[model samples]
Target: MADAVALRQALAAFLGDTQYRKFVARGMYRGRMAYWQEQEWTRFTTAHPEFAVDLNELAAALLVCHLHGDELKPDTAEVFHGCMDLARWYVEARSRLFPYAAQDVISTEGRPFEGDRIGVLFCPACRVARAGWRRR
Candidate 1:
């Protein structure tokens, strides 16, 4: 998996242009990312007003790192995977209390080419492409 630094760089590249870098340098990305991410939660919260506990943020962090493999510390791959496992656990455990957007699990735009497959989540679209992984 990519290390934190690499992931950050990838994120910068993904966002494209120098604007993202400038934004991060100014700490604006952090706030924007947080706000947008909160939007994801807010949609769920409205339906489940009692929902207040969650740790998907950690999974998201690791996912971003894993997807940006070239940047994450090479050795941290396992750590990132571990975090994903826990994140899955958290999602499943809390599903009964707070409904999760199924589409969120499987990516919609497909995985990034520069992304690491080692610990990346398979989106439904990807599944359609690889449905014949072991065709007889």
Candidate 2:
């Protein structure tokens, strides 16, 4: 199959399954509205290897659509753009919220001290740090 079709199929499979779709939607709707890092994307797809190729290709295409050809290439950008408003909502909602209270839990050995870990936070689809702190 052509690369685009294969990638789309992969993405469709990922999106067709409720759980996998929810995870991608969460990342796209949550976190920052920026392109995800290669490491992060690989990590996420590794957790769902069945859709690894599709996710990687789809994500790359979405980045291209998002960055260029937004005006004259609306159709090409629809999939990624579909998540823009939701991302905006996440950004705004998190911005209006309050910061979480600092905890005194025992630190894990060798783990970086970057304040709180993203796992404990109410993460959006992006999986990166949110724009601000907010109570869940």
* Candidate 2 TM-score to native: 0.22
For each candidate, the alpha-carbon lDDT, in order, equals: 0.35, 0.36
Worst 10 residues of 2 by lDDT: 69-78
Runs in model 1 lying further than 4 Å from the true structure: 1-33, 57-117, 130-136
- Among residues 3 or more apart in sequence or in different chains, the pairs in candidate 2 whose N, CA or C atoms overlap within 3 Å are 26-125, 27-125, 27-126, 30-124, 30-125
- Model 1 gets an lDDT of 0.35
What shift in Å separates residue 131 of candidate 1 from its native position after superposition? Answer: 6.2
lDDT of 1 by residue, 1-136 (tens): 2243444454455455454433332332433445644554455446444433334332333332122122122221111211223377645533332221122233324434343333433233322323333241
